[model samples]
Target: MQGLARGIVVLGVMLAGVQAAHAQPIKSPQDQACRDEARARVFSTPDPQGVGPYVIGRQIYMACMQRASHRASVPHRRAAKRVKRAKRAKHR
Candidate 1:
């Protein structure tokens, strides 16, 4: 009976961990605006390279997207750190 109880507890803890890890990070409004602006800028410009305008536009859009995304995800990163610290404290 004790063994069974221990197994169930372990399973519950594992599921909780999985749920936490799978939770989606919330996107900030600024991130959305940044992406929208990048999209518009890329689409509005003519292909300067001429050989492959889309490729150049795509590169520019992606660079903008990454920078904005990284900035916007700062809160998520901080929350993750807090979670990690809490878990460490719990274990100790």
Candidate 2:
């Protein structure tokens, strides 16, 4: 039982780390909008009996979330460019 518990904990930590590494921080209004839209789409589908719609729904939801977050990050890319410009200006 102890060993099982430890294994579960390890698995949970690893999963969390992977999620953190892959997750893009959503900072834009459009990203938020996309996320909201995706959330709606994910839940819109009715669960198919026996096929386990909950499980499938979760997978879809995660994909939608990723897409939404990616969309949201587009605007923030300019911030990186601005930082590079500033750095160049400082050196000049």
Q: What's each prediction's TM-score?
A: 0.31, 0.44
Please provide, for model 1 over 4-41, each residue's C-alpha lDDT reduced to its tens digit, 9 standing for 90 to 100: 99999999999999999965463766546655665577
lDDT score for candidate 2 against the true structure: 0.73
Model 1 regions more than 4 Å off? 1-35, 43-48, 73-92
The superposed Cα distance between candidate 2 and the true structure at residue 59, in angstroms, equals 13
* Candidate that scores best on lDDT: 2
Give one digit per residue, the lDDT tens place, for model 2 in 1-92: 99999999999999999989966788777656655665666556676664564465556656766877677667777788999999999999
lDDT against the true structure, each candidate: 0.72, 0.73
Best by TM-score: 2
Candidate 2: which stretches are off by over 4 Å?
45-92
Residue 58, candidate 1: C-alpha displacement in angstroms: 0.8
Which ten contiguous residues of candidate 2 have the minimum total lDDT?
49-58
